[model samples]
Target: MRVDLHPFAGIGWPGRERCGPMRRCLPQLRDSRVGIFGVGSALAPHVSRQLDLLPALVPALEHGSPRERLARRIFDNACIDERRFCIPDFRHGTRKVLYDTLHPGLGRRMAVYRREAPRLAASACEPALKSARVAADEITHLVVVTCTGIFTPGPDVELAERLSLQSDVERTIVGFMGCSGAFHGMRVARRAALERNARVLLVCVELCSLHQRDEAGAGALVAQSIFADGATAVVLGAIRDHDRTLALLGEDRTCLEPGTRAALTWEMRDDGFAVRLSPELPSLVEGRVARFVTPLLDGIDPQVRPAWIVHPGGAAILRAVQRGLGLERDDLASAWSVLRRLGNTSSSAVLYVLEEALARLAVGAEGVMLGFGPGLTFEALRFQRGPGV
Candidate 1:
């Protein structure tokens, strides 16, 4: 069975010390041949060059004009450049790099994914399926994780049938966990690994482009510019006898700073999931996330040769994590690319970083996976690469 687990990693407050005090423990983790799978997602409803979107861009709209300037300043601080989705403008950038889409963040449940899933699957999902297929003919379990859309009996069922997977393969759908939902899905898949003694596929797709909010004010504008759409699927399954396997180590969940609930919240709005982002998020993350990390990576090592898989929630969030974690400039290099390339794909974003870490980094590199969302919750994973020993 595969252990799809990352216990304590996030976009904020990533500490070099927290990444297991440095060095890939592949030499010590005991399991080195574990296999992990992934796909870089692409979604549609392509945003052709975004224009001067307001409302969501400025905060004063929500509270009125008394604080317009101050709100704009807050949004500006997020340090964003022009934001857009895969859609080409009247005639945008190169078609090869830029994805064509109508906007994945548009409709509700089925419509949203139905509208965008085909594109995402075509670009990201199909490849992941092939990667997994190289190793297993039968997918014992299918875990679909998403925060962007919801379909009554979700895409997992559809994907299973499409993949020629056995009808009896266990299916689990995790929805609306926001950007951190992949962690939750993987956590559940970890359990499925034990129960079924089988292969499992964990899919995380977030068409942030679809749920694009109007740039109401600075906060919304920064948010609108910063978040984009994408998806990633990781395959985790135990090798029959390989001791050095990519194994799902474990997972940890923490609810920190309860009073800050109003700071970060995602509510259903007619347009889509209108995110009620509070200014309190950054500082809140700075203050409480450190405590969460100390406990999660404790047993591994404390000397600090830790590797990191941070969610590219935003460049600011990455900064917040760096300042809090005492990490080096390269600590979150992968995360930055994900953001620069894909913006924020909601829940799927963090795992995208994890996928990068798994591919480029060597096995003994210690890693801490982290992501944040509503409920003022922080989900972390303490893990390292698989089977490369």
Candidate 2:
């Protein structure tokens, strides 16, 4: 195997002292054939269907203000039937714990994240390891991706210990990359496997509910209505004689759209993080979807329509992708089902849809996965189903 040395392999990078202890060598996975051996996901225990939760939220939002009206419209059109939350009180009608005078500080939110993220990661990882028929110590690397929480001794380290991985296993934490983070994680794992021939464990866990703000504005209300908590784990390695799952062949990412930099943003605040979502986000994506994505899709196969596994940013975002790709609604049934059941689990959203798609994907079927994030970026992965799941 050709092991590519990172730039700072032996000698630390300049200004390394200024960086935090959590910093490590950059992941140097290069282009190679990597098999996705297994995928497993876990949802928080607290669940609430939309029918019960939306009515309960009416009182928290203004009874008749424009924000309230906008929230009602957003929720009515959300197409999400239910979502799971790590916080018990956010379930359905129990709004007083979070919505009433509860401006949870950043510290409190981080505390919850530190406590819950590892458990969720473990819950997902265990099943994945089992499916891959691999043990904890056999994992040569651990990669954890998240956008909702920040803490030293972060989820990556915690998950490694929780799973009893080797003390010196290479580690990486791809943080704050927004909804598209999971795709980045997959790329990282693919590289690790292809470069060093290492089996990589990848986990993406987000507790978006922990960063909730009680603000009554359209952005806050809309974010609250759609975001939730979930985690997913996948085992990746170089394709071998025994490897027979979906193989990640290649990926494409688009440059940020002009003047749309701030369309979707996640910012840290003293009293938890604030989400700034533009109402025009759907339209912006729709306008550029074809131009940005058609080339990528055509590169995979000009004649065949690969299954479109899209990120469930929301109802509108999914529709925008569909219209952009000239795909029918039925083409996005898995994406819609994930959104309806799990809401947008931030970085885990696309993986959830991929898991649903994997179950029904037939051998010889081609696939295209897409995710959008803060850069107004679009990330796509092209893959083909192997003989076995």
Model 2 lDDT tens row, 231-286? 99888888766667654554444456667889999888888888889989998877
Q: Candidate 1 overall Cα lDDT vs. reference?
A: 0.61
lDDT values for all models: 0.61, 0.77
Give the range of the ten consecutive residues with the poorest summed lDDT in model 1. 1-10
Query: What tens-digit string does per-residue lDDT give for candidate 1 at 1-389?
Result: 22222233333333433223323332333442334533344444454322332333332355446455444554455444334443332233345221133232334334646655635644555666565553334678888877766776567766775666787888888878887888888778766765545777777767665565434554565576567666677666665554344434543544544577787777777656777776667777776666556555655654545777777778678888876666665878888877665567788788777766667777666677888877777877767666542
Cα RMSD, model 1? 7.6
Instruction: Please give the TM-score that candidate 2 achieves against the real structure.
Output: 0.87
Q: Count of backbone clashes for each model? A: 74, 1
